[model samples]
Target: MRIEKEYRIFEDIEEVRIFNATKKDFYKPTPKEFDVEDMPFQELLNNVSTEIHSFIPYENGKDFIIQRLGTFTLNKYNSKPKDAMGRRLSKISPLFFDILHEYFLEVYESHTPKKIRFVYYNGKKLTKLSTAKIVFDMDRIFVVTNNVDTATNRRVDADYRTFDEDKTNMMENFSQTGSYYKVHGKYVWSQGVYNIINRAKEDSDDFYNIVFDLVIPEDQHIVDKIFYLTNNETSQCGEVIRIRTANGVMKVIEVNIYSYFDDSGIIIRQGLINDITQRSDYGLSKPVDFLMDGFKNSKKLALLIEPLSKKQYEFSKGFYYMIEKDYGDYNHSRKIMKNIVEKDVVKNLNKLINGELDKIDEVLTFKVDGNSNNKKIVELYIERFNYNNEVHSLGFLTDVTEDIEKQDKLVASNEQKVVLIKEIHHRVKNNLQVLNSFLNLEKRAYKNDPDLIIEHMQTRLTSLALLHEKTYGTKDFVNINLKDYLVDHDMKTEGFMELPSQVEFETIVDEDLNLSIEVITPLLLIIDELTMNAIKHAFPDNTATDNKITKQITKLNEGDARLIIKDNGVGIPDSKSISKNLGCEIIKSLTSQLGGKISLIECEKGTAYELIFPIRMDHTIN
Candidate 1:
């Protein structure tokens, strides 16, 4: 048999790094391939060790250091190790350690020994306690610090854990501050710290508190510096703060801090910063508050300059609220600002703000020159009020000087377009009228049987002409207010007979919904045809006329409308002439084109024809 040769990607020696050798292969090892599942567990352990080592940088291991010292390991589970115990050198599985162990591993080197310790407490003693092994993952260590309180009282004795009104209110305020000092020892963190401190106190452990003092740590003190430098102590971490000065203006300060670094290294801390003054009773005195207040009180507009009275200016800087409104309406913002300003003022300052009022809605730059920061802030809002237990929207104005200028240019262009549109409608209407005149001339030329021929032709021409009239009268050239125009036409027509003067013919339509000009034409012709037929046939002789009639035009929704013509008269007789009337035939045909349903009912009092049609009013603006 020929000698077999096995091919491998790496040299035999290199392949050995990945594959393990069997007992007999130590001298002349047989080739073996490595698979994902077959990879040595020791390799996985080494890789984890390398990752942990790389993550914990030299300068940012403060939190991790404190954590690892505090945590318990399988090798060192008892009290502090005075000497290096042989057990300390034993191997530890990553699973045996807690989340803090992995967290520490992510930040620190695997081979590095953990240093520092932290004991958590919920009371004067470390009772009912558990400990974590601070590994490279222990950057989230529970360290001992008293400068800022982080206690939650949820763990207090069950019987005494009932809801507390004052504490609840304080909790809310504390929440606003982002982090608050839990004055009482009822909080869990406080209990933890108290327990840890007492334990240390019992054992004379003064090393922890002595390391950190009342003063902020140098590395984690950026916030303290910004607040102290700006002297804006009103800022609280993790919350929105409003600062209002003596005047009625306001300033809003939002502070957020997500990281802290101490002697050992960097740590993560997340919280909001808010100014309590913004929420206090005197917020109206802030500067922004005053301006917003003035804007709201003014009829047309309002204008405000920066650097108002210190108190008012502070209020202005601190004021903050959300403005909401319906689609296409700007009034929501104005209303929100107005409500905030007016609610806090005793006297209206309209007189002083009168001249400036007209420009309130106008866009302008609000510049504060005293501070190094100088920029214009733009705002827009609308007027609103709550009436009859409901909120009603009023018009809104905006500081859109640039936007307004552009809009003005656009409007100018649109105006030119409007003129052209009007001209087109006018020309179309005139042409339709001229055609009507031509029909009249034709009638004169064809004098024989003129009544029958002219009537049919006139109805057709009028149907076309009605569209022009509707187009010219409507603000939107595409949609027509057919009901109003038709009712007007009925009033204007000279030959139409009238019912009791008090009886009214009305149209109930949704003003917001628009309808196409095409639909209106067929609808009008159908109405005219029915009305004329009814007038002529319903009361054949005027001497026998003792009936009332009224028409109702109602739109069901955006896509459909109904027309009802009811009268008190003799019902239709069972004759083909009644159904075969030319007008009736034309009505049915036209109704088909409109995608509508027609019903003719002979009620005991009279006859009623209800016409329903589908319509789409394209009113969405680009």
Candidate 2:
């Protein structure tokens, strides 16, 4: 079976009626009766309802219209005056007189009015009361404007009743500034005294019972008190507040309670926090004694340096600058000194200080200015500066100056001696050469003499000439190359010694050997005489002629040398035989001066003369 569903619409049909307690009947009272004093509240309400019901035009025998008019009628005694429609529903024409009536009724009954007549324009306009409504039950209560629903919502109708922009905005601001609400659910014109009292009672009760819930007013009061202190500028505003912490040290807090009012009347609150904590404790009363001591020491140092001349003082200042706290000032002073000081002096001082150059140890010989004595005294005082350590360089300067002067004089003397020695050697060599030339010339003049006699003279002349030549050419005239002397003398034999020259001469010599010229002269002559004798007599027969004569000049050591002359000539005829010859005796005497000895040998090679001696090549007579 199919079921059909029916929908029923239910509306609120609460019946509202008014009863007159004084008249004991429901009667339509004229608008004039609304002014009657001493009427009960219910009497006034019933008169207004009855008048509204009877006056309302009915259509088609319908009581709904009358009922609607009666329900909507505002009680004139308790409602503020309204417009034409509102006045007509009140049962009286003069609505202001109803205010008088309500006031008198309160006096006569010895009671406060339970309901109040308030002129609240239900419509939104500020001046015009377009619709008026009465508050049925209310007390003294706050009324605040609030945001209304827009026309799109079902609450508003086609008549376009809305709040004015300025009034609406004012209400919105007032509502936000403080808490408020109407006591009764009624517009301002219909509000009663009871509604206000009831509203006040409700708020007071809430505050008494649940005071913890009201945080806004209390917080605002605290904020106001803090701002009052900050705005007075009695102290440094926005300074962090510090207190002794649990750790027993002062710590700054971040709480900000200060506010500054700007020129445009805007208040800006700022945070009071800082990285550095301000000191609040006073431990010591007087300044530290140690700090005073330091100040006194600094002043003493400054005074001690002040006695010096500006330049000297600055020098001392530079020393102090190294240890000063502000190094920039010290560096600035140093730069000034560097720019003004002489460059050469600085360079010399730098060299001495850095140990790159040695300091002078004796006075320098600079000519003194404006001195009557004309003394050549040394000036040796040192200019002092510090490098690695403190040293007394004054002594070094004095000693070195004196030493340098002595060295210079000695060098000059040595140079003069060298010149004199060279000149002596040159002169002696020339004289000996002249003597050799003279001997040659003399020998030529005596052509009639025996060959042996002339040969002997020439050899002796050659020996003298060789000595002078060696000394003249030598690096040190005091020393001669012994090998050169021997070679020179042996070469001369071709001119002097006659042939079938049975003496075939040879020399073995030290290539790098040198000897004193004094020794060389005597040694050369000794070899010459011995070699001549060997050639003339050692080879008495042609048997010795086939052999050679050997002469050796050698350095036995650094300090000694030997000259050995030997030949295949016949052996010395006899030691006494050669000893009788003047040449042999002269050779022996010269050998003795050389601190040497000569030996004559009778070997198969013939006769040999070996001379061993000390060569004092570096000896100086000066």
Candidate 3:
């Protein structure tokens, strides 16, 4: 019995067409007579013992068509008899078609069976996730699909249970009252302690900046705390201070700071702040005695030199450890400084020593002769101070290699963003020039036909607009998905023609094809002009029952690309007619702009053009 059916093809474009044919006509190779051993699994296994949820026999031909689907397969997909009986596999599962297509090609070539596990979302919002497995038969190209969603969910639930138990145990050991915070340079992660103290949460507030503002103005010791922490002189400190909350309420809090060297040699500071406002004896009058003994064990290198004599010097234990030496192994500070510090820094140090400069503060890059011989960037500060009736210089050297590297990377990223902006500007300027040229041509050629001029100009501008729209919708600003751009242009062209239901439009583009903006802009204009011309001139009577147009793009071998635009309308009568057509001239010009050659393809029903272009790999415009 013959039945009429409509189906759609391609993932990006919904190309619909209606055709009437017998049920057997849908399968290309014609389904073999149903036999027990001819089933999908019977050919794979000697004995059929397992259960099958969805068994689909697909004909491997130019188009992957489903010969027939088992009752279970129909129920699993929630499809009707007519839909599953004689339809393309892509219509059943558009998202999974590419995967199935790849497997079909492999099995067709090598005659080797394949198996794949995939997840399918059924609903429109894609809220339900169902896992399915496809197993290919070597002898027969049918697929055995089994829904394994239940089994997969069991394993996922077990993982969640174990994670919940671990999280519960961790929460039981964590302190709920004290707030914990960690700071590494400008990055800060906290447990909302500062927000509670401020009495209001602010998205833009920085942890360290907020803490500094919270400390009462009279508490000048916070400056000293920051200095010691910044120089990595102390490992831990505790202080009781008064802070005014956002509500103008004064409260007492005890803050404990701990500093440690991370694996990358960057110092990280962790803090815990406890509110002690209700306590009667909060130790408000007591002084904060910083941990001065931590200097010996600290990672920072310190130096004390008698500037006048230039002979007496004392180096911290960190300096000796850094140089791979024991205490008193290197006595002369000048000798050690000359080897590690840059010559310019040493010259500045001499200036400080000779009273030419009051102090010297700078970041200098140098390499130390140590076990690893790694380059070190250090922030150096030296100032002369009176001690024991003698002129001495107390200087601290903090390793800032990691911080400086991070800053350099940030600067490089900003510069790259600027270059991208400039490229975008250049693309815009070029598009404007092209549009202006079209305007001038339209003025000279079709001055009397204002409506025709506006129509052509409108479609050209729409083509450019759609190109930018697709390019901006994606994360990649340099190139856009070629298939997506073609589908969008097809839709806009139809909008211009206002023939939504009259023409059967289709786009069969390679899903992986992407082209740079420089190529796409001109390429899209050419497609638009050709497609619109066919729609206008191809179907003069607009009564043909099989009016169809198709746009296909595929990657060719040797780094070339092919674009084909064809229709089933009346073919072009004469080849010379194209030479005198203005639209044809525009198409030729645009094809040349892309460094591509255009030629007419011989088709039985209607006109077809093939454009071969060298794909740009560098994604840059000349």
Candidate 4:
């Protein structure tokens, strides 16, 4: 028989008092069995055990004061009393200190008992495996630490190595936004599966119950498949399914399952779940096929972009068609962006690409190279989303060239209507002024005869009304054809006035001359005044019977035009008397208003007045 030596593990317990009275508060050891100044407490603590240590957390949480140090801590850290006592824990192990700071805070604030297990290493070799228990009472803290058994230590080290390898494999093969789980027997979940599916460790234990409860009714077939795989020990299976979250949001996920047997001959199933809610598709399923069909049939170009990289990941066929390219390559989308005409649109697109903007809804214009070299207008809408823990942008570009052109035409039409309204208003205001001027003249000329003044007013108003009626009837409100206006004026005057039966009126006008309302208004008034004067005075009751009046308008040149009014009646009795007649004076004033000069012609049998005025180049039809 072999003789076996027994090993006893020692526990080190320490009590510390927190002193708040000092300027710099600190914790000090309160040894109940020994005097403060005698017996060398450090040596006593060191000789007790080689596997335990006790400490009091400082106010900062990251640093601690050593209340007692066992041989294990001393040997593993190679620490001395003076150097290690009341020192920052970061000075020894900054990474470990950071890891334990939260636990230190939790124990201190809760004032409750807590236990923590950790491994300590000396260089590359594992030196100690221990567990720490902390308690607080009566303004004091008691800490106890014990060394773990050799078997437990070895098992923990092996588990840590296996965990690291599994973690590496998972990261290499699966999405980071996914979670891994292991199930044993009927719906029994592993301890490592926490906060997945049901979001609570206790609730996640019954995997089948959680799956059935969370899965959408339409995706019940997926749950059935999972159940069958778990029961039949299937090698592997993957499926995309939808579930409703606790908050009433629908989520899409991809589940990959692998089945095996544990050492105890119990069936074990491993599952990898990836939340693919933001992805457009998983595989060539009905949903993906329908989505691709939608993209193909849509007139808008759909695309996906990586926000951080500003790179196009996927695009629909319409994108290539819009660019006039047979296929899409890496540089093709960039080429399309280069054709954007608006710099602000480019900046907004960059903002969407860089995750600076959440959404962009705007119309952008592009100068496209094509047969006609026409500009294409497109409505661009982009929205930001997350996929696999990274920001992405989904966007659509709709060709709105025809729609935009129609909108522009409508706007132009409205603007033209506004201009026409303003021109009409201006013409009405001018006609009113002319009527007011006529009223003043008639009041002065025929003040003694109210009826005669009213008659003159009516005649002048009639002429103005005729001009307006002609203008309002036609589409062209600003300019009037001189020939048409003169003919209409003659017909309208016949309805209002009665002349000698022997007298006849004839008009000869240039067919291509179109005059604006400004010129036509004053010119028609002058013609009315001159014709009335000719009918009333030149062809009097006792005068010659065979009388004729001729009104001729001719374009002399590009810059000037002539108007001649001749009547075959008695000439002015005396040339000096011409200034005395109000009609003659009015004609002179109106001729001046037209920026023209007037001269009386030496006719053989009639009194003739000739007027010449400047004509605008645009007034001519040709």
Clashes of each: 84, 39, 0, 1
What C-alpha lDDT values do all the predictions have? 0.39, 0.40, 0.58, 0.60
Top-TM-score structure, candidate number: 4
Arranged by TM-score, best first = 4, 3, 2, 1
Best by lDDT: 4
Q: Write the per-residue lDDT of candidate 4 for residues 1-622, one digit (tens) a residue.
A: 1111111111111111111222111122222321122123556655564334455666645455454555554544555545445445554544435555555666767886766544433232223345567666533344556664332211121221223334333222222234343332124332222222435444223322444457788999888777556545456778888877665656677777666545564335556565565563533211122333467755556543332343434456676666566653435344556778888988987787666888888888877653337677888887775532345455667788888889999998888777767777887887788778877886888789887666566677888888878886674644689998888778777776767667877999999887776677778888888888887778876545778888999989876889999898877889888767777777888888888888888988879988888665233211
Task: Write down the RMSD of all candidates, one decimal each.
Answer: 27.5, 34.3, 46.2, 17.9
Assess candidate 3 and give its TM-score to the true structure: 0.44
Off by over 4 Å in 1: 1-448, 452-471, 478-483, 494-514, 574-579, 617-622
lDDT of 3 by residue, 320-434 (tens): 6555567755655455555555678878877886788868897876566632356678777777654212354556667677888899999987886676677777877898898
Residue 126, model 1: Cα distance from true site in angstroms: 90
**Tens digits of lDDT, candidate 2, 1-622:** 1111111111011111111222212223443312212212534644442222222212211211111123233342333222222223224433323332333333234433222222222221111111112222121111111212121213222122122323222222211111111111111111111121112222122111111122234244543444345445422233333334222443332233333433553333322222122222434121122322333333112111211122322122222322333423443222322421245544654565556655522233322232334323333333333211222122211113345668898997798678768667665775477446535654565457656556667787777766655665453556576666676777777666674535466788888887766666666667767776666576667643366778877778887777767766546546777676656766777788678888765566566667888877334444
lDDT string for model 1 (1-622, tens) is: 0111121111110000112222222112112221112112434533342111112222343222111221122123443322211111111222122223433454354543332222333222221222122232233323221111122223322332233333333222322222212111121122222211122222211111211121123423643343333222322234233433223334343445333322343222222334344456645321122224444433333332221221222111122211222223332122222332232221222321332222222233332222224433335332223321222222233333456668889998798577758666665675467456545654665568676555546554555555565665554555566655665656543223443333333344455445665566566667766765665566554556455556777778767988788766565776456776556766886688567998886577667888888775332222
The local lDDT score (0 to 100) that residue 387 gets in candidate 3 is 25
lDDT of 3 at 219: 76
Clash pairs, candidate 3, are none
TM-scores of the candidates are 0.31, 0.33, 0.44, 0.51
Q: Is candidate 2 or candidate 3 better by lDDT?
A: 3
